[model samples]
Target: MFMVGRESEAFKHCTPIPILGVACYAFGLHLLKTCGIMRSIARADLDFSYITSRLAVMSQPAEGLVESAYRNHAEDVRALLEGRHKGHYTVYNLSGRRSGALSLHSGDATHMSGGNVVDCPGWKSHRAPPLSALYTLCEVMYDFLEADPKNICIAQCMDGKASSATLVCAFLMFVNMFPRPEDAAQMFAVKRTPPGLQPSEM
Candidate 1:
């Protein structure tokens, strides 16, 4: 599911501006972050860390899921460039990579330069990443958000269920938005889908 979180506050500023959350599935899209003949507060997919093969895809209702992936990836940036989201947005990304992302950004600067995006190589699907690695990810996230409040960070994992969700929760706690990880987890559960965290995630 593609969950777009609004400008979350950090004290008085909108630091950690907007955290865009989505799952991994957009295999056909070759997304490149372009801004104003370009983009703004871009709402494209954050990351795709699948096994980089057909086995990564779901076995049932494959067409619908794939189509949704294609549509979301294609439409989001088009909407932004079309002036639908008029605000100037510097989007960052915080997620993991399995080997590396496939068609998602094989030719884009986001992949090549690692711009505002931070890849957590310790992470895989269904299970959460190492706690130490999570701390590092949160630090990078805080630095990114602190640099500019208007900057939005996008995050994702295989399905935004385990690693992705935990990262969000950890960021919330790390930034003191929530006093505890459990509090952040509760908030994530309320905002996103029901299965916000798997057992391992907790």
Candidate 2:
């Protein structure tokens, strides 16, 4: 588990935190507050994106009751049940991966051993995903959340910084949890990673 961004042992794996109305489990792989962590990532890589205009939220129906569909995807469910997890499995990955990410019904992967990775390469550290990609990614996110409102989704990225946080913020705003993107960003900042703003700016 390569956690990053956050600086708490409670998040040794993932810690559940609410973003507006969505339940998010964030995992920061890098050591907290170390120079290596800071040197490795740019400040923009962990900052929230300010909204320029109202985002065109996606309004679509879920493909299916998809939550936990990947939990038992392996041929050996008994083996899966027997094993305990030190960290939350990367059930969903929001990168541009074509295979071995979603359940057998959703994509081509023999099993869920390799967590579900969405084909969303455009979404990176410094930029938001493209509109086309955003629609697909958020739709998948919404489907899983809607399949069971109790569902807890983990939003993670390569380093667990802005990319993951951005996903949660975008989803929260998509569901109208916040009126503006900035509101969602602010909520995340206060709860997860506080911006490196000076006292005057704060």
TM-score of each: 0.50, 0.43
lDDT of 2 by residue, 1-202 (tens): 2233444333233323434333222211221212322222122322212211111111111223572242222223212212321121223344333324223334311222222323344545445566665555656655554443223344544433456556666665555445565555665564456323222211
- lDDT (tens digit, per residue) of candidate 1 on 10-110: 22131222223222111111011122322213443522212111001110111244646543342343243234322322222223432132223232212
Over the full model, what C-alpha lDDT does candidate 1 score relative to the true structure?
Answer: 0.38
| Pairs that collide, model 1 | 35-38, 35-39, 36-39, 41-89
State the displacement of the C-alpha of residue 133, model 1, in Å, after optimal TM-score superposition: 0.9
How many clashing residue pairs are found in candidate 1? 4
The C-alpha local distance difference test score for the whole of candidate 2 amounts to: 0.37
Off by over 4 Å in 1: 1-71, 74-116
Cα displacement (angstroms), candidate 1, residue 120, comes to 2.6
- Show the lowest summed lDDT stretch of 10 residues, model 2: 52-61
Candidate 1, run of 10 with poorest lDDT:
52-61
